[model samples]
Every structure is written in C-alpha cells, then in structure tokens.
Target: MDDTCAGEKSHLFCGFFLNFSLFGTGVVYTLTSATSMRAIQRANCYHRDGHDAPCSVGGDAYYMFLFGLAQAVLLQIPGFHEMAGLSVFAAVMSFFYSFVGVGLGVAKVIANGVIMGSIGGIPMVSTTQKVWRVSQAVGDILFAYPFSLVLLEIELINTHEMRFDQMKDTLKSTPPENKTMKTATRASLVITAFFYLCCGCLGYAAFGDGTPGNLLTGFGFYEPYWLIDLANLCIVLHLLGGYQVYTQPVFGFADRHFAGDAASVEVPVPMLGKRRVSVFRLCFRTAYVAATTALAVWFPYFNQVIGLLGAFTFWPLAIYFPVEMYLTRNKVMPWSKQWVAIHGFSLVCLLISAFASIGSAVGVFGSETS
Candidate 1:
C-alpha cells in the first residue's frame, strides 16, 4: 500500500482497538462490581427486602445506548469547532465537576473507614488502607483516558472469543441450535466496523493530509457539525447513567449492611455537607459535559487528538487487565513465549501512539500560528 493508505489503515486499526479496549474495561468493571454487590446483599440477609440488584449487562447497555445517541446528535451542530473562546471556562467547569465527583466518592469511602475504625477502636492507619487509597487515585487518573482504550480492547477480545466458542459448539453438535442472535450480532458488528472505518478514514483524510481547509472538509462528514448537538444530548444521558452506576454500589452497601443507628450511616443529608457536595458535583458534571461537547464541536480537528489519546492511554487497560485477571483467578494461562510477544507488541504500540499524539498536537498548534 502507499504511505497515505498505510497511515490511514494504521489510524483505523488504532481507533478500533482503542474503542474495543475501553468498552471491554467498562463491561468487566461493571460486571465484577455488580456480582460483588449482589454477593454482599445476599450475605447480609438483605435479599429479602425486595430491592432490585444491579447488573453489569444492564449498566453496559445503558451507557452504550447513551454514547451512541450522543454521537448521533453531536455530529450535526454548526460552528462547534470555532467555539474555543469558551475553552478555558469549559475546562475549568469540567475539572471542578470531575473533582467533586471524585471527592464525594472518596469521602463516602473515608466515612465508611472511619465508622469501621470507631467500631473496632483502632487508632492507627493500616497499610492496606493506604495502599487502597493510592491505588484508587491511580485508577481514577488511568480511567480518564487509558481505561477507555483498555475497555475497547477487552470488548474486541471477548467478542472474538465468543465467536470462536460459538463455532466450536456448532461443530460439536449433530445439528446446530438457532443462530439468529449470533448472526445478527455479527452482522451488527460488521456494519458498525464499516462506519467506524469510514469515519476514521474521513477524519485522517481531512486532517492528516496537512492542508488548509482540510478540517472544514472533514467536518462535513468525518466530524460533521451536528455531532456537537448530538454529543451534548448523549453526554447528558451519559452523566445520568454514570451517576446511577456510580451511586448504586454505595447505596446498595449502605442499605444492606448499615443498621439504622450505626453512627456510620452516610445518608444524604439535606442542606448540609452531602447536599453541598451533591450540588457541586451536579454543576461540575453538567459543565464538563457541556464543555466537552463544545470543544468537540468548536475544534472538530481535535477529534483525531481525542481518538489518539483515547487509544493510547486505554489500550493497556482494555487488553491486559482481563487477561491478567483471568490468569490470576484461574491460573490457567501459562507464561509462555506468546505472552512475552504480546507484551512487547503492546509496549511498542503504546510508545508509537504517545509520540504520534504529541506530534499531532504540535503540528495542529503550529499550523494555527502560521
């Protein structure tokens, strides 16, 4: 293939890989958390209360639907890319909002810790607690971009494995069972992949060619003006889904385990500490969603940057975590030669992606200056 064609292919591959990785991570985390929460509810004899438990499948589907819907809207808005005059405000708002959400989540955990300590009369910091807090912060930062890529990788791997398993089962049977769902799913995958490929190609063609007005041309279809409006709506739904998913575990834990007068009841206090925090979180997340939508709209050219960052950071989280978890849990996958090769490949891809992102950022800025 020619250099341009090869570059386009590489970009497409990276985009698909990243999306699959990030989505996969989301699925795994949601499922595992749901399963653990369910077990906790059962063990505490709280299952008899008739409360509906959370499920990973439901959460995943909800977020996916929201994301798809948002993308559809965001691609249709005009002047979305030139609104960078509001970038600083948007960024600040998003940062504060994200910070509040993080703080609230952390505060709840700390409150739980304090209550446990009070019950036990323990006065010292435990090594596990320190490690956990540090790990949680690291996880938060990683999830910001890297985790998305990782989730996408996991999704792709899981899908491939499922297909393989289905094929194997069919071979083993005298007559295969109805393959309607599997066929439809595969068909959907093919169609989605085709559209994604087209978007990636159009994005690269519009920007990667390093010409004037390329961005405008690309935005016509690749980054389309309407995407901003769509993104805004999608983001709002995403935030709602995210809030639900994030709060469900904490609510579940509190409801099932905490007794009415346990001094550890971190119930939502009206017009007090909890309310203040909640308001801040709501404002922040709303601003964040708005800003992100605006940025994507105003600088349609940045879609490539977003894609690159999403792919680079999240690829490891998506592809490696599940494999690591599976190996740790089952002790089935031996550390063979193939494992070494995969790790090496992952590392190289990461480095390339990182450098390319930096280079692209510099180039975009340079072009604007000249």
Candidate 2:
C-alpha cells in the first residue's frame, strides 16, 4: 500500500463511518437515560389509572431527538480532545447502566410476571421484514466488537504502545495477524454478545412485544425511581465522552484538509488578515452536528435509525471497503475461492442492509405523509 493512501484516505473513510456509528451510539445512550426518566413518570401515571398501564411504557422517542440537538452544542467546544480523558469514566458509567438495566428487567419479570414473557413471545415477522431488521440489528450491534477495530487504529500513533520508529511503521506495529489483537478482538465481541443477550432476555421477558428501544426503560421506574435517575445520569456522562472520541478524528480530518497540515502546524486562514484558525473546521463540524441533530429531531425512530444507518453506512465501511482493501493489498484474485466467498458474502450483506434501510425509510416517512 502507498504510504499516504493508508495515511489520509483510509483514515478519512474510517473516520466517516466510525463517526456515523459513534453518533448513532451516542443518540441511543443519551436517549436511553432520558427515555427511562419519561417511562418512570409514565409508570407513576399508570399506577393511578388501571387502563393506562400498558401504554405508559411505550412513550414516543421523538423528544429524545430534540434533546440530542441541544447536546450537539458540546461538540462545538474548541478543546474537544482535551476532554477525551473522560471516556474512561464514561465507560465505567456504561458498565453500571448495563448491569442495572439487566437487574431491573429481571426484577420486573419476577414481580409483574413477564410481559408476554417467553422465547415464544418474540414476534414472527415476514421474511423480508426479518431480513431488513436482522441486517440493521447486526449493524447496530457492531458497537460490540467491531467498534474496537476503529479504535485500534489509534494505536498506530499512540506513543504508549510503541517507541518512535515503531510508531512510524503502521503495518509492522499493528499487523492484522497479531495474536494479542486477535484474542482481544474475539474475546470482547463474545463478551459483548453475551452481555446483550442476557439483557435482552430479561427486557423481552418483562415487556415482550412492547419492549422499548432502550431495554433500560422497559423496566419502568415505578418502585425504584432512584435507579432510573442514577442510570440516566450515567448515560449522559458516557455520551459526553463518546461524542468526542468519534468526532475528534472528523474534526482533525477537516482541519488538515483545509489548512494543509495538522491543526498544530498552523496555516493562515485565507482572506482573514492572517487569522490562523481553520474556519472551515468550525463550519464543517457545526454543520455535521447540526445535520445529525436535525435528523434525530425529525425521524427519531431509534430502531429504524439503527437499521437505516447500518444498511447505508455499514455495508460500505464494515463490509465492502475492508474486503476490497485486503484483496488489493495482498494481490488476491477476484476468482480465488477465498476472495469469491468473502466478497460475495459482503455483497449479499450490502444488498440486505440497503433494502432494509430503504424499507425502514419508507415506513417512517410514509406514516407521516399518510
């Protein structure tokens, strides 16, 4: 691979899709906590009226989008990378919420008698619908292990991982065949999958068909409102940190592309009396955040957004580019069995993800038009 090809282009595409995934993940987390608080309030209302109980938990997810727009202001801060250290604490907060969510779901099942409460309660959908949702679901779930691959790319320039010369050599320092990377990657994925399944089982058992997009909210903070408040607080903090990690690369990419070098290696802004700020940096990030926030405010269908983003973004980022890059790097033939099977499978996934996104877009928008 040409040095600069892997350098700028790979990072650009990686940042784009990686940020897409991160932004979506941020919305979900921010929404998760906010939705739980709403659910808690609704649960209180339901307690007074016997007929309103079932409807209490399925609150519309739109308000969360509005909140998302408000939070985007944080992305506009000048020293975003400085706050990146908070990600560690944010991660810890995430662990707490995940555990608490599972616990609440389990308790709900035991106390209220599972919602439809069984494996059988999982609704059967048409094959086409299943294909769309399944593809979307898998794409959303990429937050699990595959998300780490994007993060791992940072190790290349990270001085903590290597001395000076090693930092300069990306392929050697972080080879795809590295055993430690392979093990960590596989283990994190399995653990994440198991964690999600456990949480899903509990939530599904408690709410069944009415399970909220956020499993945490499905617990409905009736008895222990404190838990709902606490968990949501954690989510907010986590999202603050997450938004930066995903967008910092994007911010850097734009700054460099426009300024002709890294932000630190100052280049003069044109037509500004030698003002040094990368003004494109400001407009670019602000618009990106605004656009995402607007999308959130408009549709705000959490599951549907997941499906659409996965289908639209993941097929290219997660499936096609990586496979094509590998083949081109290794001089592998399209006719080779390994190439044929892997690339072919990628194509199939891309199709399914695309169709799923389209189907979801129609469903979301069609409802409004009608």
Q: Against the hidden reference, what TM-scores do the models get?
A: 0.32, 0.71
Best by TM-score: 2
The positional error of residue 69 in candidate 2, measured at the CA in angstroms, is 7.1
The CA lDDT at 259 in model 2 is: 48
Tens digit per residue, CA lDDT, model 2, 2-109: 343366776666667766766665555544445654665665555555433565445444546545554554554555345434556666887888888888888878
Q: Tell me how far the alpha carbon of residue 142 in candidate 1 is from the true structure, in angstroms, after superposition.
A: 16
Give the per-residue Cα lDDT of candidate 2 at 209.
73
Where does candidate 2 stray beyond 4 Å?
A: 1-73, 76-84, 112-184, 219-221, 259-283, 329-333
Candidate 2 TM-score over all chains jointly: 0.71
